[model samples]
Target: MESADETNTKLNGKSPSPVRSTRPKRSVRLTVKPKCFRCDKCKCEFSDQTNLDYHVSIHATDKPFHCETCQLLFSKRASLKAHVRTHSAAASAAKKKVFKCDNCGSKFTTSSHLKRHTRTHTGEKPFVCDVCGSKFTQNSHLKSHARKHTTDKLFACKNCPSKFSRGSDLKAHVRSHVVEKTLKCDSCDAKFSKKSHLVRHKRKHSGERPFHCDQCAAAFPENYMLKRHMRRHSGEKLFHCDICGSKFLEKLYLKRHMYTHSTEKPFHCDTCGSNFSQKIYLKSHMLVHNGEKRYQCEMCDSKFLRRQHLTIHIRKHTGERPHQCTICLSKFLTSSNLKTHLRTHTGEKPYHCDTCGSNFSENSTLKDHMRTHTGEKPFWCSICGSSFIKNSNLKSHMRKHTGEKPFHCNICASDFSQSSSLKKHMQTHLNKYQPL
Candidate 1:
C-alpha cells in the first residue's frame, strides 16, 4: 500500500479489503452448575450463599421482623410481608356486605358462603368422592373424605406409632404427649391443657350452670352437657358397648361401661397402692388419702370430695328429684339411684358372688357379701375397739354409745337408732289398727 489516505481518495473514498484466515473457530458450551451451599440442620441445598444464609435464619429462635398490625414475630421480612396480607384480607372481609339466608335466617359475608350453607337445608351434596363414592356438601369436604381411602399418611408422630393424614391431627396427637398445662383451676388442684377446659372446670366450683335445658329445669356448665341432658328427654342412645351390647346416651358412659368388662386397671394410687380402671376414679380416690374435700354444700355443713356427690347432697335439701321410677312413680336424686330402684321391680341381680354363688342388686351389697367369706372386718370403732363387717353395722353399734335416733315413724312420731328397729316399731302401729 503506497499511502492509506491517498489510496482511499484514488479509489473514490473506498478502502482495500482484508485477507480471510483459515483458523478453526473455538466452540464454547454452557452448562448448569450443582448447588454447593447446604444447611447443617435440614440438609437443604442452595445455589448461592445469600439464599443459604436466609434459609439458615429460619432455624434460629430470634425473630427480627415483626408485623405492625398483630405484633406477630417472623424470622424474615418476606414472612412478615406474607402475614400482613392476612390482616389486609381480614380488614377487607369486615367491610364486605353480608348475604342472608331466607330459609334459616343465617347471615354470611359472601354470596358463595350463603350458597354453601343453603345445601344443608336442601340436603344437597354436590361434591362426590371418586374413590369411596361418598357425597359431600363442598369440594373441601370431599377432599377430606378422600383422605380416608388414601394410604399415604404424610404426617407422623415423633413420639408414638400414630400416623395421621392431616398435619392438624398430628399436631393434636402431639399435644397429648408433650402438653404444657399452664391453665389451672384456682378452686382445686386441677390443671388443663386448654384455657377453655379450665374455664369449664371453674364453673363447677362457682356453681354456675349457664347452659339450661329447654325441656327440663336441669342446668349444666357446658353446652355439651346440655346436649347430653337433651338426649335423656329424646331417649336417644347413640353410643353402644361392643362387649356387653349395652347402649348409652353419651360416649363417656360407654367408655365407663367398657371398664367393667376390662380386667386391666391403668390408673394407680401411690398413697394406698390401689388401682382404678379410669383416671377420674383414681383422682377421686386420691381425695380419700389426702383428706381434701373441695366441693361443699351451700345449704348445709356437708362437704364432699366429688362434685357429683355434692350435687346429690344438695338435692336432699332442695328436694329436686329429677330421676323418677315409671312403675311406682317414686322419685330419686340421681340416675344411678333410679337404676338401682328399677332393679327391685325387674328382680335383676347383676352383681354375683363367685365364692357363695349369691346374687345382689347392688355392687356394694355384693362387696359386703364377699367380706363375709373373707372374714375381713374393715370398719372399726375408735372408742370401744369394736370391729364390724359392714360400715352400716359399725354406724348402728356406735349409736348405742352416743345414742342418736335418725329413723322416725310418721304414725307414732317415735324415733329409732336403726332403720330395722324403726320398721319393727312401725309393725306395732299395724297391730294397734287391727280389724279383729
Candidate 2:
C-alpha cells in the first residue's frame, strides 16, 4: 500500500515526503472504496477529484490565474484566458480594422466573434439548455437562461431588497436605484444605465432597423421588439389575467392590468390626496396638478400630459383611423375607442356601479354616474361658488361669467351663451320672417 505523501507525489509529480511514515511497510491488499469529494460551501458532490478541486477553488479568495491586461483574478485558467480576449478586442476596435462578416458587413475583433455573428444569417443555435431545451447561438446566453430553472440567487442588491441569479442583471438593477447613467448617446442627450441600452437608443436616431420579421414586412430596431411583433402573427398571448380572463401581449401589461382588480391603492397623490393602485398612474395624475404637458402634437397646437393622448390627438388631423370594427365596419382613431364601439355592438357593459347596481359600457360614464350616488363634484368653477358633476357643464357655465357667446345667429348677428338659447332666439326671427 502507498502512503499519503507518496500519493501526493504521484498526483502533483513533486519530490518525496520530508516526514517518515509511521505505518509498517507492508503490502496491504485491502479493498479500496471509491472516494466521493463534497464541497463544503455549496454542498455539491462530485465523483472526479479534478472536478472537485476546480469547484473548491471557486469558493476561495486566492486565485491562481490572473489576466495581465486588467489584473483581474479568476479561479480557473479558462476564465482568465477569456478575460484577456476583451482587452485585445478593445484594442483592435480602436484601430477600426478586424474580421468582417461577409453576410451583414459587421466587423468583429476576433474570428470567433465573426463566426458567431454569421450564425444570425444561418439561423443556427449551437448552444442548447439541457433543462428546458432552449437554444442559443452563444454559450453565455445558454448559461444565463439556465439560471431561470435554478432556485439559487447568488447575487444580491445592496441598495434594494432584491436578488438576482446573474451578476450582470444585479449590476443593471443597481443602476435603477442610483442616478448614475454611465452610457450616453452621441447624437442625443439621452443617457442609459448600460451600453446595450445606449446602443438601442442610438438606433432610434440612426433609423436603423436590424431585426426583421420573417413572416411579414415589419422590421424593428431590437430583437425583443421583433419577438413581440411575431406574437401578433402567431396569435400568442403569453400573459393572461385570471380575474377577467383577458389575455395580453406582454407580461408588463398584464401586471399593470392586475392593478385594476386590486382594491388597495398604495400610491397616494400629495396635492389632491387621491390614491392610485399603481405608482405610474399617480405620477401621471401629478402632472395634472403641475400642469405639465410634455407631449405635443407636430400637426396642431394641442399638447398632452401623456404621449398616448398626443398620439390620439394627432389622428384627428391625419384622419388616420387604424382601428376598425369587424361587426359594424366602423373606424376609430384609438384602440380604446374601438373597444367602446365593440361594447355597443356586443352589449358588453364591463363597468358596474356597486351602490346603484347599474352597469355602463364606458368607464367615464360609470364614473359620472357614481357622482350621483356619492355626491362627488370633482369639477369646480373658479369665478362662482358653484360646483358641477361634469367638466363640460362647468365650461358652459363659465361662458356665462365671461359673457363670451359662441353660438351666433346668421341673420341678426345676435349671440347667446347656450346653444339651446340661441335656437330659441332663432325661432323669434323665424316667426318674424314668416309669410302671413
State the lDDT of candidate 2 residue by residue for 1-436, as single tens digits: 9999888998999897578889989886976556588766555677778888877776555566765433456878877887889767655574763687676565655788667767656757798889977677688878877998898876666667687887688767966786678777889788875455566687789988866665468988876798799666544454656555556889999999887654467999888787798999997788899977889888778889888888788889989999999997999998888988988888877666777779888766876787898797878899887999988889999998999899989988998899999999989989998999
Model 2: lDDT of residue 142: 81
- TM-score for candidate 2: 0.46
Off-target runs (Cα >4 Å) in candidate 1 are 1-245, 249-252, 261-275, 409-414, 426-436
**Candidate 2: which pairs clash?**
none
Tens digit of per-residue lDDT, candidate 1, span 1-436: 5787677767886655667889988899987767999877545688889989988876555677776543456888888888889867755774573787777565556898778767655667788777766666688867776888888776666678788886667778877896778887888899986555676687778988866664469988766687688666545455655443456778888888877644467898887676688998998787798867889898878788888899889888888999999999999998989999998999988666777778788777877787788898878899999999998999999999999999999987899999999988889889988999
User: lDDT per model, in order?
Assistant: 0.77, 0.76
| TM-score of every prediction relative to native | 0.44, 0.46
C-alpha-based local distance difference test score of model 1: 0.77
